[model samples]
Target: MNTPAHLLMGAAVFGRPAQTKILLAAFFGAVLPDLSLYVMAGTSLLILGISPQRVFNELYFSDAWQTVFAIDNSFILWGILCLVAIWWRRPWAVALTGAALLHLCLDFPLHHDDGRPHFWPMSNWVFESPVSYWDSAQGANWVAPIELVMALACGVVLLVRRVPIWAVPLTLVLMAAEIWIVRQWLFFFTNS
Candidate 1:
């Protein structure tokens, strides 16, 4: 799933009492895994003065970079965070970690050969599903529409729950925009 979809799901699951901090934590949790890409891209841009597209090309094709950043999306990190939450008895941390885990769970069945190293640190294993969230050739063309509907449904739930009036619309717009951007990026990456 894309970041906005993950954020919407996190909000639907954890956004309650309309507390800003809690919602923010949930958003961050959903976004944390993808931060590895941001960090790698940002550093490459700064140090190498490369265009964003070039940086993306390198990251997408580089096995070494994938291995290095894979830890960010690993179940090992989730487990460690859960253990920390348990040890500290921090409900907020637990909620954040749970949101991240939800992100991982949603991603698990949607990735093909380029699946995440979900069991990293303990083992280098990736459960390559036949369907991919972004790859149309891998059956994501059908799945994409379903995900959009699910995200819209989640937005409705947020609205019904009386979340900030702008939240639902903003989430929907961001999801749509992200979907467009990612598809374009994928097209360029694949055809270039």
Candidate 2:
């Protein structure tokens, strides 16, 4: 799933209208899994001046990068943290780790060739689902639109739950971004 979709889903699932801290925690947890990718890829594209093809095709699937992905995308680690948070009776912590776990859960079945080692230390196995959210050849033409709709529905859920006024325009902006991203995936990626 796109990062924006994850953010909206996290906010809807774990965020509270008045609890800024919890909402922020949910947002952080949602993005944390993808943060390393952004940082590494951004540095490669901008600072290191790497071509998009090499950066995504080669570096993205490298052992070192996959290792980092394993730790962040690990269901075991996030599940442990979630349990610890629940034991400690920390709602914010629970929301944080719980949302992260949720992110991994959602990502698990949506990824095809790009699947991560979600089980990690317990197992190095990567479950390559039959569908992918971004890969056109992997049913993304249907999957991506459904993802966009679900993400927008999550935004509506946030609104119905009486989220802050700022969330209204934020949702709109995110919707726009998701649309643009989908268009890019459908057109640019499919053509390539």
Best by TM-score: 2
Question: Each model's RMSD to truth, in Å?
Answer: 3.3, 1.5
Which clashing pairs does model 2 show? none
Candidate 2, residues 41-150, lDDT tens digits: the string is 99999999999999989999999999999999999999999999999988888888988988998999999999899998899899999999999899999999999999
TM-scores of the candidates are 0.80, 0.94
- Location of the lowest summed lDDT over 10 successive residues in candidate 2: 16-25
Local accuracy of candidate 1 as per-residue lDDT tens digits, 1-192: 877788878777867655666666777787787788777787889987888777766565488777865787888888799689869977667667877888888998998876778888887777889988777778776777688767667766766887766575766686677667566636653422
How accurate locally is residue 113 in candidate 2, as Cα lDDT from 0 to 100? Answer: 97
* Reference-based lDDT, residue 112, model 2: 96
